[model samples]
Target: MFRFEDNKCYRMPAHFGGFDCPGPEAALYYKDAVSVTFTYTTDEKQLASYVPEGFELLRPELNISYSQFREIDWMAGGAYNLVQVSVPARFNGKRDQLEGQFILVVWENKTWPILGGREETGIPKIYADIEDLHTIQPNYYTSASYEGNTFLRLELLGAKPVNGQLLSEMQASAATINALGWRYIPKVGAPGADLSQPILYPQGAEVHSAWAGSGTVKWTQLSWEQNPGQWHIIKALAELPMLEMAPVIMAKGVIILKPNNGRVLE
Candidate 1:
C-alpha cells in the first residue's frame, strides 16, 4: 500500500520535504510560493481539448474502491522519499514555464498488508500487521490552478470521500490513512488562499523532531536526521488496514513497524 506518483509521471517518495519543477521557463512561471494554481473561464470549449490524465478529477464523489488503495502502502525495505510542496504562486499563477523543489521533511511509514479472511458478513478484508489502538492519521497535499486558465487537478489514486468529511487535519497516529479531498481556496495569494492540509503523524516519524512524541503540528518543510532520543515512532503498520475505496486526497503511508534495527539515514 505504498507507491505514489504525480500526474506528470514522477513517483512519489516517502517522507516528502518539498517538491520543485525545473524547466527552462521555470522561473518565469514558478516565481511565487511553491504552489499550483489555474484560472478557469466557463468557455466549455476552452478546456475541450483538455485530457485529464495523471491527475484525477477534483469533483463530487465518495469513497475509493477497495482495489484502488494499495498504491500508497508499497515501499521497499529501507526505501524512503520526500513530500515536497510548491505553490503556484511561484509563477504568480502564470503558466509560461515552471520548476518546483521538494524540501526534505523525510520521515518514513513502511506499511505491510496481509490477506485476512472475510468479516462476519463475509466481506473480504485486509488486516494490518500492527498492534491495536495505534492511531491512524491522514496526510494531505494540494495544488491550485494558475494563469493558464488551466485547471490543475490532483489525480486521486485512492478512495474518494464517502461523505464530504475532510480529515486534512485529522489527529491520531494511524493504523492506516483516510479520506483525501481538495478544497476550493482561491489563490488571490494570501494566507486565506492556503488550502494545504496537515496530517497528524506519529512522533519521531522524523529523525530530528521537536515535539515530545505526541503533538499536532504543521510546518513549511520536513527532513530526516537521526536524533534517537529526540524523535519517536509510536505507530505501527498494523494500524492502517486496507479498505476498498478510492480516497481522493489521502493515501495510506507505509505500514511501519517498530524501529529496532533501522538506522538513521543522513
Candidate 2:
C-alpha cells in the first residue's frame, strides 16, 4: 500500500521490495565549472507578474548562463551541463539591498539533479539534450536543445587569471548577494489549493576561483507544451529586445554551492 502526502509517497514496509531510494543522495557537490553570463535588455512590466510580493524588478537586464560541471559527487563522478535564465530583482523596494536573481528556467542533462533542484529549491528545471564540445584547445562550446529546436548556444573564447582588484570586487559582490534567497512558485498536488504561497530557498554559491574572459551567447524559442503557469515566462521572453550576441561576463571557475534546508517564506 502507498500513501501520498505533501507531494511525496510513503510506502508501507510490507510493500517494500528491498529497494533503495529512487533518487540521488540528499546533496550534490560540484567539482569544477566553466560558465558564461550574458545580459540582455527586456521590458520590465513583462516580468512584473512573475516577481513575488516584497520584491521589485531591479533592472531590465536579463542574465542567461551556460555552465558545464565536472566531477559531480553523484552519478559516479560523471559530468553534466546546465543552462539558466534569470532576472535581477530587489527585495522590499530597497534599492541598495539587492536580492539574488530570480531563476525563470533551468535546463540540465541529468535527471537526478533536475528532480532534486525542482523539488528542493523550487527551481523550474527540466531535462534536455545538452551538448558540451571543445572545438579547439582551451575553447569550450555548449548548446541545449529540446524537440529538435536549439534554444541556447555558448562559446568561451579564452580565459586568464584574475587580478587582485577584480577578485576582491567579485568576492564582495558574491558576499552581498549570498544573503538573499530565491523565491519561486511551488507545485501544487491538489486542485483549488492555495497557489499564492511562494517557496523560498536559502541557497548561494561560494566562488573558489574566478577567471576573466570573453564569450558569445544566442537564444531561440523553445518548442514545448506550455501550461498556464508558463505563459508568463514565455510572454516575458517574447517581449525582450534583441539580446546582445556577446557575453558581458565570461568566467571559468569552481564553486561550492550552499543550499540550506528549504522552507516556505509565506
Candidate 3:
C-alpha cells in the first residue's frame, strides 16, 4: 500500500507488482543527445546462436550510443547519462523488412528507469558511470565505465543540427524500430504436462521520437567483459575483426512501454 501525506508519498510492501510501483516519479527530456553507430562484421553462425530459432540477422552491423539528458524531472537529475549496444536484425525470416535493432545491453546512471525497463520489457539494464563532458568548444567527449574498467570512449567533433529531410527520415525510422526482447518461462511439474518444452515470449515496444542529428564519430571499445550471464555473447563480438565505423546517428527521444502484444513463437 501507498499513502500520500504532506506532499510526500510512501510505498509499502503490499503495493508491489500489478504495475503499481511508484513513479515514473519523474519525466525526462533531452535536447542534445550524442549517439554513435559502429558497423562490424561477425561470423554468421555465431550470431545466429544468440537469437531465437526463426529470427534472422539482417546485417553484421552493431550500434553503440552514448547520450546525456538535458532535462530530468527529479531534483537531483544532473546530466543523467546512458549507453546502449544493439544489432540490426529481422524476425520470422523476413529479410525484406527490418524488424528493428535488438538491444544487446544497456547501461545507465539512474535507478528508476533501469528497474522499470528491466521489469516491463526485459531489456538488460545495468548501472554504470557515464560522462559526457565538454573539454573544448564545439567538441564533446563521452565515456562509459563500470567497476574501474572503461568499456567505451567517444569524441564528437563539430556538432551541428540535422537537416529537415534527414530529420524526417530519422523520425520515421525511429517510429518503426521497435524494441525487441526475449522472455522465458520455465516449465512447471504438473500431471500429464510437457516438461521438455519451455515457454518463450517475444516482446516489443513502441518507439516514438522527433529529434535526431549527426556528427563525426571517433569511437573506441576498450574492454568487453562478460559480467552477466545473458551478455556472454558480447565476448564473441569483441573478437571480430574491426570493420569501418558508420557516422554517428544521435537522437533525443522517448520510448513508450506498451503491454506485450507481440507474436509468441512456440
Candidate 4:
C-alpha cells in the first residue's frame, strides 16, 4: 500500500521515490543574465479574452522578452535561454487582491526547468530552442523556434548604458515582482481537472547594468505542420495588434528564483 505524506514535494513517478524539499531560503541563482524586453499596447477587449476570470486587466499593454541565462546554480553551472509573453493584471481573489505580470506563455530551451516550473510553481512553461544572444556592439538579437521552424524574434537596437540617476528612477518606479500563473492538471481519462487554481510566484533580481534601446518583436504565424501542439498559441499572439510601442530595455542582472516560496492564491 502507498500513502502520501504531509509537507512533502512530489512529481511524476512519485511512487518510485522522493527527494528532499528545499527550504524557503533556497534559491536558483542565475548569473550573467541578459534580457531584452519591450512592452506595447494592444486591443483591450482581445487581451481580456485571454485572461482568466477573477483577473482585471490593468492596461492594454503586453510585454515580450527574450533572455540568455548562464552559470546556473541548480544545474551545476549550466546554461539555458528563454522567451516570455506577459500582461499586467490584478487578481481579485477572495482573500487577497494582488497585482503582477500574468504570464501568457513562456518557452525554455531545457526540459528540467520547464517540468519543475510547471509542476511546482505553476509557470506556464513550454519548450523552444532559444538561440544565444547575438550582439553587434550596439545591437542585440535572439530568436525562438520549434523543430527548426522559427516562430519569434526579438531585437534591441542602439542600446546604450543608462546613467546613474535615470537607472535609480527606473528602479524606484518599478512595481512589485509578483508573477501570476494558472495551474491546471487534468485527471486521467476524465474531462475535469484533478487540480486547478491560481498561483503566486514571487522572484527578485539584482541588476548590474541596464540599457535603453529601440526594441522590435516579430511573431510568426505558426502552422500545424510547423508547430502542431503550439500553432494556435503562436497564431493568436501574432494577431495581437500593436497599438503603441514603448522603449525597449536591455538589462544585465542576477535572477533569484524562489520555487519553495511560491504559494497558491486564495
Candidate 5:
C-alpha cells in the first residue's frame, strides 16, 4: 500500500552506501521521503517537531520492542556523523544567492534511537548535486503493521506489499508444496516495532522472517546476525521446478539504488 506514485527516486538507506556520496556531485533519488520529516528543527520548540514544513528532517516515531531491536540492528556500517548546518542565506524566501542557499542536512542513525533516522535526514553533501535536493510532493508509505511494529525504509520507493495477500498464500504454499520458494531467515520484531531498524533481508544472509512469501526465504544467522540476508538466486525458475536457487531479488529497493545486493549501502 506504500506507493506514492513513483515520485522519481532517492531510496538510499543501508546507510547512504551508494548513489555516490563521497564528493563530486551525487544524489539523484528522492521521491519525497516523507519530506525528510522536516530537516531537523526542534530544540526549544519542546524538542523540535513538525508534520509538514521542510527542507528535510524526520526521524522520530520509534516505539521499540522486538528484543530491543535485537541489540543494534540500527544499520549504517561505514559511519557518518557530520553536523555542520549553516543556512542563513534567507532560506524559504531564497536570498543571499548561493544558488539561493536552501539547506537542510541530516543523516541520523542515532544508533537505534527507536526507529532511528526516520527518512535518514537530508543526506546531500558529498559535494552536493542532484540539483541540490529540496523537494517532496509524493513518495510512499504503508506499514501500519507487519507483525512486529515494522518500519523498514532505507530506500523503498513505490514499494508494494503490506501482506501482499498473505504473501500470495505464502507463494502458493511454496509452489504446491516445496518445489521451492521461501528462503529468507533470521528476523524477529513484534513487540512495539523498533527492531533496531535495518532488517530488509535478501542479499546472501542467514535468518529472519515474517513473510518471504514462499519466495524461498532462508538465512539462519551466524555472524553479523540480524539484517543483511542472502540473495544470489542464480536459477530456480522463480523458485520451484528443477530448483537451482541462487539468483533472488525481491529485497526491496533504495540501498542507494542498488549497491550490488550485499552492499553496506555501496
Candidate 6:
C-alpha cells in the first residue's frame, strides 16, 4: 500500500520514493553567477499577441538574458547555463492582481531543472545547448542552439563597472521580483488540458558587482527542417522588431530561487 504525503514533492516514476521537499523559506543558492541582459523596445501589437488572455502587456519592451550559474546548492555544486526571454506584464485574476515579468520561454542546457521546473512550477522550459558566457575583458558573448543549429545569439560590449550607490539603487528598485508563469498539463491522450492555471514564482538576487553596457541580439529565423519542433517559436521571436535599444547590464551575483515559495495565482 502507498500513501501520498501532503508536504512531499513527487514527479515521474512515483513508485520510487519522492525527493526531499525544501522548506518554503529555504534558499536555493546560485553562487558565482554572471549574466548578460539585453532589453529593447519591440512592436507592441506583435508582443501583445503572445500574452495570454488574463495577462495585460505592460510595455512593448522585451528582455533577453543569458547566464552561467556555478555551484548551485540544489545541483550539489554543479553548473548549468540558460537563456530566458520575458516581457513586462500584469496578471489579472479573479482574486489576485499582480504586476511582474511574464516569462515567454526559457531554454536550459540541462534536462534536470527543465523537468522539475515545467512539471512543478509551470515554467515554459525547453531544452537547448546554451554555451558558456564567453568573455574577452569588456566584451561578452553567448548563444543557444539545438543539434548544432544556432537560433539565438547575444553580445555585450564595453561594459563598465557601476558604483555601489547606483547598484544599490538598482537593487532596491527590483527587490521584489515576481515571475509569472502558466502551467498547463495536457490530459492523457487528449487535446485539452487536465490542469491549466497561472503561477507566481518569487525570486531575488544579491548583487556583489555589476556593469552597464551596450548590447545586441540576433534571432535567427529558424526553419522547420532546422528546429523541427521549435521553429515556430523561434520564428515568432525573430519577427519581433527591435525598434529601440535599451541600456544593457552585466551582473555578478548570488541568485535566490524560492521554488518552495511558489503558488498558484487566482
- The best candidate by TM-score is 6
lDDT of 4 by residue, 1-266 (tens): 77777766778878866667889888778987887888999999999888999888999999997888999999999998999899999999999799999999999999998998888888999999999989997998888999999999888889989979988766654423788999988899989999899998988677778999887888888889999999999998999999888989887878887877889998
- On lDDT, the leading prediction is 6
lDDT of 5 by residue, 164-238 (tens): 565455344322210001111234654443322211111111111221211122212222222122111111111
Per-residue lDDT value at 75 in model 2: 61
Model 2 lDDT at residue 35? 63
Using Cα atoms with residue i matched to residue i, what is each candidate's TM-score against the true structure?
0.17, 0.71, 0.64, 0.95, 0.16, 0.96
Q: What would the per-residue lDDT of candidate 6 be over residues 139-217, giving only the tens digit for each residue? A: 8888999999999999998999998689998777555689998999999987999989999999878877889989889
Tell me the tens digit of each residue's lDDT in model 3 across 128-206.
7787655474556677666655656666555555667777667666544455555432347644533222112232212
| Pairs of residues at least 3 apart in sequence or in different chains that clash in candidate 4 | none
Query: What's model 1's overall lDDT?
Result: 0.21
lDDT against the true structure, each candidate = 0.21, 0.61, 0.53, 0.87, 0.22, 0.89
For model 2 the TM-score comes to 0.71
Clashes of 5: 58
TM-score of 6: 0.96
Expressed as tens digits, the lDDT of each residue in 207-255 for candidate 2 is 5566555666665654345233344444456567754444345444554
Q: What's the ranking of the predictions by lDDT, best on top?
A: 6, 4, 2, 3, 5, 1
lDDT measured at residue 182 in model 3 versus the true structure, 0 to 100:
53
Worst lDDT 10-window in candidate 5: 62-71
Q: Could you tell me how far off, in angstroms, the CA of residue 100 lies in candidate 1 after the best superposition?
A: 6.5
Stretches off by above 4 angstroms in model 5 are 1-44, 49-91, 95-251, 257-266
